[model samples]
Target: TTCWFAPGSGSSRGQGPPQQFNQVQTTYFTSIEILSDLYKKKVLIDDYLVDAYIDTGSKVNIISYEAAQNVTSSMEPSNVIMRGFGGLHAQSLGKVAFKLFIDDLHINSCAEITTKSNLGSIDLIIGQPTINHPDISLVTTSKSVTLLKNNISDNFLTEMQLSSTDFISKVTLFLSDDVELSPGAQCEVDVYTDHELDTSHVIVTQPKIFSLGNVSYFIPQAVLTKTPYRLQVVNLGVHSINWSANKLIIRAEVFACRYVLSVNI
Candidate 1:
């Protein structure tokens, strides 16, 4: 449960939308209790509490201007220029010191930004940079973030491929049940070759699934890519299906250019 605001309104002038802007604008209703806190000078900003958005695509942390004014009366200005869906907008490039409580956990840091928009109902945009550390697990569906302190091992990468003639609506590839890897291990699955342009439009799931029968798969072509793609599997389903080992393992990394394959999924 997250809501999105386009960087610019319909009135701004520039290229339509920014690249990789995938969220819908409709308000997302959820029962999850949102947490808040304040950060400044590497310390908590007194009793200020703010709601945060767990955005996976956002590369930086952002705060509303109203929230900033409530926390402090005077502060240094920022020079960072942030561009959104519309185009370019000025964002103060100053460090943020805030406190946030997720469930019973409390965290204080000096890494945050203050913006001007109302941010709809969200006060903070907890982007990639903030969660880059291994401790943060920003689960969008659950509207919660889990912060762990211990380091975890990385998982082995897995790849997948589908036949061009197969009309399957969906496919899931699963890894071995005993092979425990890091939670964020990079998984690459090649659906088809460049020459087979028609088959390149396949969709791969994130956090590749490795469950029942020690395999998972996905179907229905979506996009084309020349190089091997690193996919992330986001969910797990019931345990009733098994996969065949003879299943094709499409080449991951492609070098020289080749002809396109014209088959439908």
Candidate 2:
């Protein structure tokens, strides 16, 4: 809320006054309906509508410490740390199982609990973990977004040629059932690409460790071109999984799913 530029702290030094820059702290939020996912049925979380902030820059989903307390489950002790853009880690109350409906969709996962009052009036902060929904689209020009299922023919299409930076393929892993991440627990995998898509050289990303829930999807995001593209996901987890169908399907913070990468043909 403060907008004034101060000269470099020590102009006396030869560094001279650094370029003046405006520092602005802003927040983006959206309205959403909240519900609890349960056995064969769903219930509203607070018997009221909830407004959630859509933050594309965040890696993990966050629920205010106070909000998490309102849920029916008990908070499990977790060592997961929340880190901001500057790498400053924030303290958390702990992690809790959260099942809720937002934007007319269902979300069942464990959300880290934060008691910080800085989230403004919103109880939930939708982060990147959910924002990558395959069907979601954000139009800043109109301040609007699109989500969920839609026909590719329903919209304009642009064929994408192979590019070094374009991810031709994607990979994911899922626990058979809801499993909690243990302290110091992590997963990793190596990604490989082939010529089935017709690229001369194989583009392989380094072994990436998984860190989706907290400060970590440490998994290496392998890049690639084809449907169910020819690739291999070497499972590194003895007890966990390694490869999954990589699609643009992600949960959105439009108030977000999985890591979704799309190629237009």
Candidate 3:
């Protein structure tokens, strides 16, 4: 019953997967373009190797039902339901405690048995709860991945409660020169923090309009309150295009409103 969506992105809604043995959960998810590498890690589920995807957007870890069959742990009923592409809903089979290895990193995690019939060629989708272990810090850049066993930071020493998610707005994309995309051109979209670091991917299917829905961001109140300063801003008021590594790059700086990005050719 397990299936993979558009690489990185999954829908945030659910229709509901039903209960009963051999019954499939019709979890719906949309295609989300994600940055991927061969960083596939393997672990045994009843002796079968499950290559896991380290998906950050996923709030929970999911393992295919077949994988669960190989493990010895009993399933703990899960109330979690998921939404897939085209908005199909699927229910989870429950959860089981499992252990795996990411290189030398010993990962002990609980994985939900999903109704996803299969994960294509791979087997597991590792989500946040499994990767958010307090003792370790994981950082993956364009070239390298660094995992810290223990570290502390005072930048965010205090947790700020968010009042709402209205900081960002959704927008579409278009060429400044108005060039049409060739049939189905594949592209990846990454959203960075204000500093252009700490990247996250949003799935953009339609080439002409890479729409990121109302994605709001939160900034610590203290940083803005005590040390008020203007940050060096890029993409503020520029409509330009360039070629980078054979891929067409469109750059636009937009104000906080819904408008089509005019990437100049």
Candidate 4:
């Protein structure tokens, strides 16, 4: 058989520049069943650790109205309309931007906020924007998903296969240098964490009973900026006090967002 094909023809046999295919963005709205249980993972939304549904099939992220309110009161107007599995449609109230921490991956993500009824029991939905992030490399199977960054994977396994404590663990701060506090004096001491944190600001709380005893010192609750968090220690005792280097001082919860320092003076 003899065949003739045009170079610019929009056909499989065409040799010219192939027809450019414009990609259309797709939005997926989850059904009650899928949103409740499928691909559920614990992700840090702003500072709250909540169960977030991971929907790789969708392109846009979503958060329940109640969840968005808890994360942030500020919401920008959004005109996105989402379609569910069974042709059900929902209108997004607005969009909120927040920091999301998925294991070792940190994403400054924005999500459309819809009514709670639209999400059923789910609070957040992590969609392709997160899974296909430029900084992340994801591998998935029928029952599991793994997230990798820079070719290194550290327990970024499926939710069922990994424990929440593995990633949401507290960070311990240690005194960075030897410090001596004089009577009725206060000093701002620098503390170091074992590893870098995802968020720049954190809330540091003194343990119920710190290693320091009979020191009459007070470490106020404060929001500390990272890369060597500074803590204020007030020595109320009548004598001098010394804290050696690398001494455990206070601990900060991972991704803690709220902290207050009150002073009467």
Candidate 5:
């Protein structure tokens, strides 16, 4: 997702374009489950089990006040600032470290975050640091996710072996010599792979293009609303190849359309 935030009043605003400001982009992972083993007891919370959003944008895993209290009874009262669609809000804080399990992969000593009930039914927001494992791929779709782990690595080769099932899809990788774009606009490059697959494991090496014919793709929105930008496609599956250049911008506009119509009505 790409987000455009208006610049605050400052001399820094003069450093860039006048109308647009900074652009924040994040690769979102969702429909994930986090299982915890407190002592000898196991606790499983699926994305459906407890409201959760896998946010690469967040740096730490945040658990709701009610959920945090339920998990750890020794939470202390503290103040923290939480940012969201409605802007910044003050939230109470606490800490806890629990074993986290995403899909079949498990990690111990994961960071725990605490927040107020204002985050709604979400039990927690899983951040990047906890889920940024090297062996696994976090595929984000319009509604779901598929976690793919490469068992051929030295760490997992002993525990498991690579199989045909690991090839979830035949992805065609592409690299642009120089990515061109309009100022304050974003673009999306679509590459058609060999088969329709569910996992997001398209790896790009140096000179990342399979074939040059009709391989160069473009979309018409500025990803960062600024002149210079870098694009990295991670954890992409074949079925979800049609990447959006300004997903956040589109989402925001769509969300506000109803409100604008209501006001006009």
Candidate 6:
């Protein structure tokens, strides 16, 4: 709530008064709805697990001085001032570099260091500098974001392109009966759900590593929501799978069109 500019810190440009130069942007929403709607993830900054907010609108990355201290004791001197909503301002201690780990992928990124009070509950704010990195690709659905290490292969890019085409939402799906599948064999299994559908067109995301050891399924097909909801499940393991009813917990993604078409008769 306090705002103070560094005294005798401005530098002269020409035949004019000393002007402040370095500055960075930050956004802190006062509304609970807006704050809750932002995409949040648990990431590792160096060795510390941090609850981070992903803000695509921001141009710079930010971290609290307390967090930076735990990660590293060194900081490059900076005159950068963080400006946010309601004319709130905080003078930066300095900038620090840290390794940001998202699952198996990690990126070396630099962020402006400020007081913990200035950051509130957020330990880190990942901005466009890291999100827009050449090796990083962020694919966002209706309620989630997929962070991919883009330098690996073209297949990841293709998958991202497909997922980005639809507004996807997840729902728990229940299997109707026990099923068995041989190695590399696939079939459409009927599923049960509690969600009342607003749209018939749904794209089911393939289930990741299931609890069943060495068993995997692929069901990336578009299906209509009917009485007996079915999804094509493939067994990608070396051995056959005799999955029991209600034993395998799978998530189904329902796609809704962002636009509605109307025609005049």
Best by TM-score: 6
- Residue by residue across 47-132, what tens digits does model 1's lDDT show? 67776665555555666666655554443434343454233343343445665554344555443344444255666666655556
The list of candidate 3 runs beyond 4 A from truth reads: 1-34, 44-48, 116-118, 146-148, 151-265
Model 2, 1-265: lDDT tens digits are 1111222212111111122322431222221222212101222344424556555555556677667767778876544444441323344455667666654555565566665454445667665556565554432323344333334424534444545424434333222223333344543322222223333323333444544433333333343332332322333333443234333212111100122233111
- State model 4's lDDT: 0.66
The C-alpha TM-scores of every prediction are: 0.35, 0.36, 0.43, 0.44, 0.36, 0.49
Q: Report the lDDT tens digits of candidate 4 across residue range 131-151.
A: 888768776667676566844
| Highest lDDT model number | 4
Q: For model 2, state the Cα shift of residue 34 in Å.
A: 21
lDDT of 3: 0.45
The predicted structure with the larger TM-score, 4 or 6, is: 6
Q: Relative to the true structure, how large is the alpha-carbon lDDT of every model?
A: 0.39, 0.41, 0.45, 0.66, 0.38, 0.64
Q: Go through the candidates in order and give the C-alpha RMSD of each one to the true structure.
A: 21.0, 25.0, 19.0, 20.0, 22.1, 18.1
CA shift of 194, model 3, Å? 33
Model 5 bad stretches (over 4 Å): 1-49, 72-80, 109-116, 141-144, 148-265
Q: Point out where model 1 deviates above 4 Å.
A: 1-46, 72-74, 111-114, 139-145, 148-265
Residues 1-265, candidate 6, lDDT per residue (tens digit)? 2222233332221211122445443332221112444377889998998878777766667787778876753677665555663445555566789889975788898887766766777778788789899887887778767678776545755567543334447777877899999999988887776666655445354545453567665655444445577777777778888878875447756655442122111
Clashes in model 5: which pairs? 175-208, 185-221, 185-222, 186-221, 186-222, 186-223
- Single out the weakest 10-residue window by summed lDDT for candidate 1: 24-33
lDDT of 3 by residue, 177-206 (tens): 222222223222322223221112121222
